[model samples]
Target: MALAIFDLDNTLLGGDSDHLWGEFIVEQRIVDPAVYKERNDAFFNDYLAGRLDIQIYLSFCLQPLAEHSAEQLVAWHAQFMREKIEPIMLPAARELIRKHRDAGDTLMIITATNRFITAPIARAFGIDILLATECEKADGRYTGHSTDIPCFRDGKVTRLDRWMLENSQSLDDSWFYSDSINDLPLLSLVDHPVAVDPDDKLRAHAEANGWQVLSLR
Candidate 1:
């Protein structure tokens, strides 16, 4: 079966959940005022600007939980998923996800979002696979950095190539849906490059390239 990879941020959802989650995390005091807020803000800025280095972004986001136990971080992530992601999921996005599920497609949430947040949200949506930036950890504590290549645009294709090699599959018949120009590398890797509410750059390229462009809200 071919894969259907969907981006999680503005493509699937109505907006960027990363900034909102950062604000929420700070407001709830799950992170420290001195570091968490500053680092997450930096990450948010870089992410929006499409300049975020995946490794550093993952590291900084997880830095707050370095002192906390793994279980505690998991619990916090669970709470963040419920409190932050559920309410923000657009009805149209939910419907689209359901449609993908009903089609028996092997759907994967391919995003730069962290595993802690995207993992539970994907599980709740009945999506089995999530390829995201995983934070480095040791002895149940975060190292404030990525242990693997953060699943960004080009990084996504790199990571997927390895996975596909092991699984005996290819991107020749796959579908990719995303909203950002930053996702162009991964989107182009697939046979069906769908631009969903894409940024201006992606939209222009999609039009010129004759790729299918979807507008969700």
Candidate 2:
């Protein structure tokens, strides 16, 4: 079967999940807003500009996971899904995924966000396979560190290739829909690269390459 990979942030949802998660933490007083809110904004801006330091960003993003128990995290995430994610779930994006599902495509969401944050969100969209940056665990608790590639920029291509090998699949008849220029590596590898509500750099790149540009907003 062919692949249909999706990016989770602004590509599918109306807002950035990682950024919104940070904001949610601040709003819930889970993290000290004074300390983390500014850094979160800065990291998000860096991401948009394609200048994010993945290690630094991941440290800030995953530390909370290490601090909280798995049960607490599940409870928090359930609340997060209700308050932040569901409201932003665009009908157009859902319909797009549905169309691909109806076509019998193998659907997945490959995101730079860590699995802890994006996994349930992917499932909410009925996607089972999520290739996201993995947070390392020790003794059933998070270590606040990634065990493998960050799955950002070029790492996405690397991770995808490895997943393809393990699954006996190929990108020969695949499609990827994303918004950021950071996804260009995997976007180029796919047979059909669709820029969904892409940033300026990605829009220009898509136009130059004759890739399809879609506005999911």
Candidate 3:
């Protein structure tokens, strides 16, 4: 059995989703531009450092769109991601995924980007299964909150472990690619821990540990 898991942000694409989401918020006029800048700066900064709390960030991100119909918000998000980010996806990355798919490997995209944003992107590639952070729903509408599982770093390792167990698969020969050292938990859990354009922490770790480091960016 083959499992090739990929990280969504920089490994697959060249940018950060949180930064783009803030731009979307401004373009959509979902929030007062002045106020959004203040909060967005802090949120984005914390997120990069792996200190941002999912529930708080999810609440703030969804707060402005709260008044809009969920369907409309989701549609707009899908369009923005497709139009802005999808076109920028690197060909090499696509080719890598395509090769894996052709080989009949199970493709799993594991990302810190929330379900509201990443789900549609995954669906675009016919990826039905995902591991993403979810915003809570109350009466079929977003409550501007996160659910119990926060899909980042260690949480990713935990969730993937459960997935492997449920599928009766072992991590012995599976492949995983990620950029940040924050993903070390999940990376270490796999037999193949690939560092894709790794951050400094991961770069040093890969060097020290003799892990195969792939820099395609």
Candidate 4:
């Protein structure tokens, strides 16, 4: 079976999950709202502009996990799923996934967002294989730091390559769908690259390369 890969934020979902998680924490009073929101928004803008420092952003984003108990975080995430995530889940995206599944493709989601935020969403979509940025944990609690190279930009390619090697998979007949220009490296590597409601940069790149462009929204 061919591999069908999806980008989690914006590509499959109607909105960005990482940025929305920051907003969710702020709204929940889990962080200093004024200061946290400003930083979160700035980071998100940098991401859109292709200038994000993943380490710095992760430092800020993961700190709350270190402070909270695992149970508390799990409860918060459940609420997050009910409120923030479910609303942005696209019906068309589900149909796309179903199509791939019906065709006997192995479906996977690769995202820059931490697994803490993305795992449940992947489950919600009935997709079992997910490659996401991992958080370091100690004594069953988050250490507020990432473990390895984040699945962002070229890092996505690195992460996927490792996964493929481990699973005896390859890019042969592989399909990848993404929204941001940051995904260009991995997107370009796949046999079939689809831009899903792409941002300006990705849109231009996809158009110039004759890549398929789709919209889930």
**Tens digits of per-residue lDDT for model 1 on 44-100?**
777667787766566566667576778887787777777777777778877888887
Which candidate has the highest TM-score of all? Answer: 4
lDDT of 3 by residue, 51-159 (tens): 7876678778866555667888877887787766787576778888888889888899998887887787777655667898877878878777777677888899888
Badly placed stretches (over 4 Å) of model 1 are 32-39
* Pairs that clash in candidate 1: 59-144, 59-145
In candidate 3, which residue ranges exceed 4 Å CA deviation?
A: none
> Which has the better lDDT: candidate 1, or candidate 4?
4
Pairwise lDDT winner, candidates 2 and 4: 4
Query: Once model 4 is optimally superposed onto the true structure by TM-score, how far is the C-alpha of residue 136 displaced, in angstroms?
Result: 0.4
Candidate 2: the clashing residue pairs are none
Window of ten residues with lowest summed lDDT in model 4? 163-172
In the range 85-166, model 4's lDDT, one tens digit per residue, is 9999999999999999999999999999999999999999999999999999999999999999899999999999999999
> What is the lDDT of every predicted structure here?
0.79, 0.94, 0.80, 0.96
Clashing pairs for model 3 are: none
Error of 3 at 143 (Å): 1.2
- What TM-score, over all chains together, does every model reach? 0.89, 0.98, 0.91, 0.99
| Candidate order, lDDT descending | 4, 2, 3, 1
Of 3 and 4, the candidate ranking higher by lDDT: 4
Model 2 residue 128 CA deviation (Å) reads: 0.8
TM-score winner between 1 and 2, please give it. Answer: 2
- On a 0 to 1 TM-score scale, where does candidate 4 land against the true structure? 0.99
